[model samples]
Target: MGFHSFESPYDWSRIDTYRRRAEQCPGGLVDLSVGSPVDPVPRSVKEALAAAADDGQARGYPKTAGDDSLRQAATDWFRRRRGVDLDALGADLVPTVGSKEAVALMASLLHLGPGDRVVQPKVSYPTYAIGTQLAGAQVTTVDDPANTDSWVDLPGVRAVWINSPGNPSGQVIDRAGLSKIVRAARSIGATVLSDECYAMLDWSGTTQVGQNVSIPASPCILEPGVCGGDASGVLCLYSMSKQSNMAGYRAALVAGDARLVKAMTAYRKQVGLIVPGPVQRAMRAALEDGEAVMAQREIYSRRLRALVQALTAYGYDAVMPQGGLYIWAQARSGDCWADMADLARMGILASPGEFYGDSHRLRFSSTISDDQLELALERLHTGA
Candidate 1:
């Protein structure tokens, strides 16, 4: 009952205040506070959704575990893109409405409550803490999540949430770093749940395996070296929102650890947390079309470069993200709210770091349209 008393993690008051100020600016606002995609969904995915919708048989209640085709597509995607072999672990995968729901429901689904401690990144998506709270579990923040020593011996730690290409910061953890965390969590008898929603949008070309083999992709927790080629005690949460522009469809899934997936799937079935049939079909189509994913990635990359250049020219220290849809920036003033207000004065809106558990940085999203990005850049350069 105490968890039920907790307030929502999002503070809409800040957004409302900024929205009102932005409305009064001379030019129309170029909103970049959130990372929601502005581009249209791929034709292949949309066609699949339409076909599924036209199928009268798809109107029936869908399976909570997802269709066999979806599961197969997800597994094939992991093998082809993430360099992870999940062929034998097909039964461990289950589609969720979206990665956010899986994130908010993981602790409860795992039955962690009353004195159980969940380890999370110090600066992370707030939903992780909210989910732990919802399960009556305590949260422990590790500032350097990639450092295994930071969490190896934490008392009462039951679950660890790893977010590579992190939300607010866009920081990525390499395979070696992920392996360290996995080993540490295993030693402590804690489960690891990795959020990999932005894996496909990697901007860094430093994904080297061993000495000579380089793969230009974000490191996955389920990578062979990261988890010793075994997915036991680990789960990965992925979404088709960023890569496929399917955020509205709410298509995502959790894969790894057969027992845990079975537990969550059983609970989700009872509660009706199923992804719709049409969305699942769309997801399968999206997973199969690698070319579409690459095309979307290139769009974000261009937007990211333009935004970073504009922010840099405006006297802000904007760092290029290795992956993910945000550029973590800091102003010389050392005040996030002050930087946010300045951007608002320029008719450009960005998220303050306070919302993401940090106070000196701001998050600028690169998911805006090309025209809007150009407008934002023009405003920054012209001081309009």
Candidate 2:
């Protein structure tokens, strides 16, 4: 299950060329390539972490399955925010150091191996393929995540990874769409892993693809309307990074099938993959602080709105994403590298569509400061 030498699925050298070009501009580079949070971590979360650190009870090794309070908080958050009703005893929830690890290790954690097939959207985070490869599984892609006919027939299907408010694409999947995938996966006994990390940043009415639901954000895979309230083989991964500005904390959790949660928790314990006590407390604080989350959402809304208008006028044919922090703009002939070259000349660094398995677009993150965004706008309005 291990390779003798490390190989990065992403080609950093390719992007570095554009970064160098952007750096050469007189005004300096306005990097919009990454999704890292640039805002301050919420005060309540920091206070909770500090309190936990000093408490004698929290100084010891934390539970791999997560503390009772943290688990309850996660379950409650799902109910109030995502319309997911988890088990009473919290058997359906397990905290991870971050959602990324959970995502990268999911195929293996589910005991998938040689000959097993894992399906994901064509335009998706690269980690999905990495995780599948690590587990000795085959990877397949469907152009549309909601199209059940596209993936239901793949041989030896074991897992399905769906990200809404998708990375790079910034497209949100509606409830009806999510339900179709759940139904298809169930018929084939495939486990579905739903990444709803950006679910809280729903920029409704400007969606490029799916319609925004009545929920506070995007439709969740575990919602009753989606899975019929039976989370038998489904899991939803949520991160506190973007919404709570807790990226540094590396706090995230997965909620789903009780059996599956128990299995993954056991595997994690055996591997000593546990969230630190203080971080666990911090995550619980984030889950309860809805006001702080909403404030952060509004901040992103303004930033994303500003970028969409700027890119549109710059002739990128940009559409405001329904959710997530990215602005997915059109590129000539779906030539991502060419788009990168064009943007680089303007002293703007962005992610090429090739990075996300796309043909004709580029992604710009809105996580930079307002001043940096204004700088980008200035550069866009004029040439480098």
- On lDDT, the candidate that comes out on top is 1
lDDT of 2 by residue, 329-349 (tens): 778546888888988888899
After best superposition, candidate 1 residue 202: deviation in angstroms?
A: 0.8
C-alpha-based local distance difference test score of model 1: 0.85
Q: List the residue pairs that clash in candidate 1.
A: none
User: Ten-residue segment with the worst summed lDDT in candidate 1?
Assistant: 206-215
Off by over 4 Å in 1: 1-3, 7-9, 89-91, 208-215
Q: Report how far off residue 87 is in candidate 2 (Å).
A: 1.8
Each prediction's number of clashing residue pairs: 0, 2
List model 1 lDDT by residue over 85-197, tens digit each: 77544338999999898998899898889888999998888899889989889888889777777777778889999998889888888888899888988988899999999
